[model samples]
Target: ASNAYGNSVGRLVRLAVIILFIYAGLLGLTGLGFKIVPGGFLPTQDRGYAIVFAQLPDASSLDRTQAVVDKISKIAHETPGILNTVEFAGFNLFGG
Candidate 1:
């Protein structure tokens, strides 16, 4: 039976089956890759600095916000992994 298939036609059939198997494996791997990948389109990298935002109101005084921010900053400085704290008060971030 094996000797009967030892011919050009047999070789072609065997090659076709091998190619089909490779294609199937690649398709399965691609599906698996999709499942493992994260949803965001943006690639992630560590950002050393982080911005902390505080808001009071449209009528809130800059000085009041600054005082609050200063207290928060002092606390942040005492915390580990906090290299520094930059206060961003109000809408401008610079906060007038």
Candidate 2:
């Protein structure tokens, strides 16, 4: 009789452990399952302004990069509200 009681108590303990794990899993699912943020901050197509691309001649060497820099600087000087200017050259063209 005592052995039967022990067996029944062990079964009940295992069932309780499984039930606790299932409940914890459900709580975690509820915490992480829903979407709060929308897809994008801005529209994909509605650009406020146009982007201008200027490519230098392929014969451009290290020295010729200065001419490209000068041209870009002149453009920056002519344009208003130029927040930033960046130049890419040589290996960085492939790197970036």
Candidate 3:
């Protein structure tokens, strides 16, 4: 409403000049490698994170799920440098 047409037209004039400056900056950086990278964001594809997601059948019982989760937790805890390993068994991690 007010922002669309209520402000001074002087704002429009300054906006056009600002746009021209931006265009000039882009044009001035042309032919430089810094202007653009050829590939996607992770072109080299070096990403690091650790997580484990396991899926059993939708009809899996809570006991069976807990058994599987316990095995995983035991395995992870046995590994070196695993300070803490929290697990979510099915939908009830804290135990039903």
Best by TM-score: 1
Q: Write the per-residue lDDT of candidate 2 for residues 24-53, one digit (tens) a residue.
A: 999888767545434476666655453445
User: lDDT winner among the candidates?
Assistant: 1
What's model 2's overall lDDT? 0.69
Higher-scoring candidate on TM-score, 1 or 3 = 1
Off by over 4 Å in 1: 1-44, 90-96
Kindly list the per-residue Cα lDDT of model 3 for residues 1-96, writing each as its tens digit: 667674766688899999999998887787565557665565566543346766778789989989998999899889886777878777743344
Q: At residue 15, what lDDT does model 1 achieve?
A: 97
Ranking 2 against 3 by TM-score, winner: 3
Worst 10 residues of 1 by lDDT: 86-95
What order do you get sorting by TM-score, best first? 1, 3, 2
lDDT tens readout by residue for model 1, 1-96: 667667877889999999999999999999999899975675566576677777677788988988888888998999998886666655564646
Candidate 2 TM-score, true structure as reference: 0.35
Error of 2 at 68 (Å): 76
Candidate lDDT values, in order: 0.80, 0.69, 0.76
